[model samples]
Target: MFDSRHIQTFAEVVRTGSYAATARDLGYTQPAISQQMKALERAAGTPLFVRAGRGLRLTDAGQVLARHATGILSTIATAHGQLKAITRLESGRVRVCAFPAANATLLPATVARVAAAHPGTRVELLEEEPPDSLRALREGRCDLALAFSTGHGGEATDADGDSDSDSEGGLIELPLLDDPLMVLLPAGHALAGSSRVELGELERERWIAGCRHCRGHFVAACAEAGFAPDIAFATDENLAVQELVAAGAGIALVPGMTLPLLRHTGLVARPLAPAVGRRVSAFVLEGHETAPVTALLLRTLSEAAADMERAASGSPRPEA
Candidate 1:
């Protein structure tokens, strides 16, 4: 019988597309990963991978094995989660992945509540972007992920269209809240005094953008308003983005969750005219939803999101 570990390693190789990456992810040496691959090939009696330029690509047999391995691993994880739930959440670790904003604003309070309530159950955080976090969730590297989607068609929704829980693709998405993208401008900027600003109005202004995806979103949002942003600075740090705006370098588009964490008061945040936003949601493998620890974390996150919504509602709006 092929060892399940070998199957898991093979699956990881498939997901990561490099033996070295798989080794790093699994904490194994590259030679060890090669040995496992060789052993797996011996058991299967066929070559499972081939060199494709600088990286490895799966062969037909490898693809077939990967499909089966995913299901097998998911089943094993479900069984493990169910068994751990039998202990009534006394112990066991839940690996969570989230984006930066959620990590800063949403996850801390929720994780604190979890730790205080279940001291024996450990929670580990991995900061990743939404796409990477979802990939990690699919590959079994994380039990839960806090993710967000923007754009008109990208919003997560159910069939009935009222809720955000997407019950498709063997995953569950629990919608938390909608975080609107707001315009950030220096206090003395030309349009800073406006209650709301349209993207087209800032076409000629220098812009500060986040990472590549965020930059793309900014450009796209501008395109929707019949203009393109002249981005002058790029950084993944939201604080740095705010700093740049405050220093008169450029303006920015920031999500609402980040507003509560800003230490700078020299910038003004105005609502966008068209109201572009992202939907924040919790993602889990379908079968693990009912696991005691997972359920507990979900409840904590839901409550935390609700509290944030309430706080945002009552807080004074940002002014120029």
Candidate 2:
């Protein structure tokens, strides 16, 4: 078998194009570098280098081996990095999936905290809705999932009827916060000055709906109010919904987690009467919940959520 050390040395030699330079760079004696090259060539069953004037050149076999060796060494370095991260808890990669709103508002500060505290750790964010985030967590495609429930009885379920249990095979859910859905209205609309609005009041108003589950919540709420909404536009994007409301196209129901991302100036938000909302939670594989990196990230997320809550309540931000 070809030793990884020899393959690394060979790649370094190709990079430097001089045995002495490779030896200096790798902290190996010139003779040791030569010996490693010979060993690599023998393992390849062909000569890998030749004399060209006062310098050395790669033979056809050497060129082929060098190409493969570069990739092999790079993979080895990556493996080493990952192993170091796992063993030390000072560095690692955490894959996170969240809906677009949370990705915009909640994830940024949490990820920034993680990056600052553990500079070696890498956090990757993926935008996905609740069902998809949970699926990604269960399939081992993601280490963390920031998912939400519409709180309108439309939560995703398996055969067991457990909304947040391991029926999906060892998945764990950590409830983070309840993000209440608030109605968005144009600033000049009839009910814009109210602190809260009844669904019945907006029955005839043009409406902007969200995803299928969100629309389901709106429809159910409207039905409870004895009317069906005249949904004029359907979009899941928080900004788009806000813009539509700002432009007087229609009103919408937006989740509290998306509050910080609202940039439209001509819109007003009011809570629903009787309190309709969504529950945002973090999901992970059962065994990974206690992992140091995952735990740290979870704490940061909770802190960020708290900050968002304070901001939403018009409270002054706490000093750092």
Candidate 3:
């Protein structure tokens, strides 16, 4: 089959007007140039040159190939340059889909870090919960996904029930943070003043649960503490949950990462005695983990998570 080497030789011959001159210009033996031209002619299924006095002249087919070769070579060169730029992290785009809580807290800081570190790079963000974001990643709709697990310690699945197992050539999950969970209590609650609250102590208090996954985690933690939570309300909205707690409707458990973004006027957040928490992670396709832009973003995400941990520790403790 015809290839770039043949096309380059043919173009050089057309430029120099003879095989001997083309060979001299390209640092090849004249016979080698002749052999390349013969192969190219065979692949083209036509004689591309004819004897004209002491020189060679192109046939119509030769002219056609000459005209198109320039464009093809230009396209190839452009592609090479762009790929090099991407490898250097000078220019590229990264699409990230994350859960709402992360979008509010971790994402902004991560995005800012990437922008400052690589001005030519760009990051696009989408807000979605775990399984859905995981689906987006598996579907190739996004380059990276930010998701969380309640320390369940198993393969996580998407909406279509596909597992993210690297052994199965699915995805790679990298842990970023151990976002601790805290108990949300009303201002006047008897246990609000405590530095930490044991799950067993809140056994009788009405609870406001979060998303389905969060509720399952909360329930499991409660079970481990030897009691069942009396879930009086259920909602995925962090602010709504805090509002309910403030109104004395019920108490709730929330991640520390989300606490800064949430209102705390009439509520108090106490560390859980048993230290229940979810693990936040970044997910990527198995082989794409080392792609330049994706890798840089992952590092920046880890840095941002560390920054969040420091901020959480240095800030005033959540009190009414």
- The lDDT of each candidate is 0.82, 0.80, 0.82
Clashing pairs in 3: none
TM-score of candidate 1 versus the correct structure, residues matched by position: 0.71
lDDT of 2 at 40: 84
Number of backbone-clashing residue pairs for each candidate, in the order shown: 0, 0, 0
lDDT of 3 by residue, 101-199 (tens): 899999999888888888978898998877888767765667788888775533233422234454553688777888999998998999999999998
Q: Higher-lDDT candidate among 1 and 2?
A: 1
Candidate 3 structure, TM-score to reference:
0.66
lDDT of 3: 0.82
Output the lDDT of residue 32, model 3: 98
**lDDT by residue for model 2 (1-320), tens:** 88998887888898988899998998989999999898888888999999888678999999888779877876677456434434433347788888888888899999998888889888988887768777666655667888776645667322123455665456677777878889999999989899899888887899999988678877887888899899999998788888888888989988877777778888888999978876788876666667888898888998988888888788988888
After best superposition, candidate 2 residue 131: deviation in angstroms? 0.3
Candidate 1 has which clashing residue pairs, if any? none
Q: What global local distance difference test value does model 2 have?
A: 0.80
